[model samples]
Target: MSQLILHHYPRSPFSEKVRTLLGFKGLRWTSVIIPAIMPKPDVIALTGGYRKTPLLQIGADIYCDTALIADVLERLAPTPTLYPAESAGLARIQAQWADSTLFWTAIAYSFQPAGLQSIFGNLPPEHLKAFMADRAAFRANAPRMRVPEAIGALRLYLEQLEAQLADDRPWLLGKATSLADFSVYHPLWYIRQAAGVAGILESYPHLTAWMERVQALGHGTSEKMESGEAVALAASSTPVSTEGEAFLDLHGLARGERVTVAATDYGVDPVEGALVLSRPNELAVRRVDARAGEVVVHFPRLGFQVQKVE
Candidate 1:
């Protein structure tokens, strides 16, 4: 297998989620630090405009969305399963909730005045403005939760998690950490990133302890590579050697057909190219970005739609 390449910037909470998972799995991966905002040429080269951070790349296969990225990593390294056999279903559902709901709440609550100041404290005003614009674009059409409401919900969720750990449970599940752990970890990691506002966790000792345990799992072995280098890697490499037999055919499309793939919400730029791989879980469009050259833009089937643009 080619090295697991991750395209991410340091401060992304979603990227943190995948990094901790990689550490837990003890996998070695290449790190490609992408721009934190728009004009992600190299990333667009591979993902066809699904500009979410922390995209996982294996060989030439690209996996978007942290939810799907988690599953892909689990498949790559299964020993310390993210999905435990006993309550895998429940764990996954809960993790999804934590990742989506709890995550947004924490962001809303933590990025309040002081938190935002702490985060962009030193960066130039223009950079901060650009960051805000980029994030605003990302959340453009999505409904936003009120700050107070988000804080209340997050507090309740944290309380529930605190109770879960009160029993001296080594993991969120029975004895070992699973998807629930990583799901819960990312948001708190974001809170921690807020520096000043992170003190909110002081009240939840158990949650803080769990955070330490997970954070200890440093992002699996990674070495930095330039964005151009990563692009060249993609251009020179052949597509992932998949059997291509597990395709589920959600769209009335076939491999090798020309199609367009884009995110359901943000970063709406559609990348049209030969639909190279439409496997059970993902869609890949082989397209050329003038800046990044030939690349395969990819996305998970969930939260993304595919069509044969006429």
Candidate 2:
């Protein structure tokens, strides 16, 4: 198997999620740091237009969304599984909630004026302005939770998490660290990084201790590689064969038809390609980039919309 290549910037919350997954799985991967904001030409070349951070690249396959990436990593390294069989369904449900509802709430609270200053304090004035503009554009058409509401909800969520851990179990879903742990960890990780804001966690000691355990996992073996090299690697390799998996289309689109797969929420940029595989929970589209040649881009069925191209 080709090296697992991750394109991410350091400060991205989702990137931290995958990075911790890599650590938890004890997998070796190549790191390709990308720009925190837009004009990400290399990423666009690989993903068509799905500009979300921490894209997982394996040979000629690009995996978007950390939810899908978690599945891919589970397939790659199954021993210390993210989804334990007995608790998989429950774990997934909790993770989905954490990734969406809890995530937005934490973001809203973490970007309060003081937290915002803490985040952009060291950056150049122009860079800070650009970052704000870029984020505003990203949030366009998306409903934002106001800071006051987010603060109330975030406190309630943390209190609940603290209660869950009060029983003295090592992890959220019991003895093992599951997908729920990682999903919940990233948002709080962001909040913890912001000055003054992390004090909120002080009220929940159990949650804070659990977070330390998750943080201690650290990013596993990773060596930096240039973006051009990763692109060349994709150009030179063939996508993993999908010969035997039967296409199961929930949408009316058929295999070999031109289609576009996009996230239903924010970061809704579409990736247009030939629909190669559609399962109950996965969708894959094969597209060819001039630099990367043929590559298969994968997205989870949840949180994404598939449409046939006219």
**TM-score for each candidate, following the candidate numbering:** 0.92, 0.98
User: How well is each residue in 145-212 modelled by candidate 2, as lDDT tens digits?
Assistant: 99899999998999999999999989999998999999999999999778767788899989999999
What C-alpha lDDT does candidate 1 achieve relative to the native structure? Answer: 0.80
- In model 2, the runs with Cα more than 4 Å from the true position are none
- Top TM-score hit: 2
Model 2 per-residue lDDT at 59: 91
lDDT of each: 0.80, 0.92
State each model's C-alpha RMSD to the native. 2.0, 0.9
Off by over 4 Å in 1: 242-244, 288-295
Clashing pairs in 2: none
Question: What's the number of clashes in each of the models?
Answer: 5, 0
- How accurate locally is residue 149 in candidate 1, as Cα lDDT from 0 to 100? 93
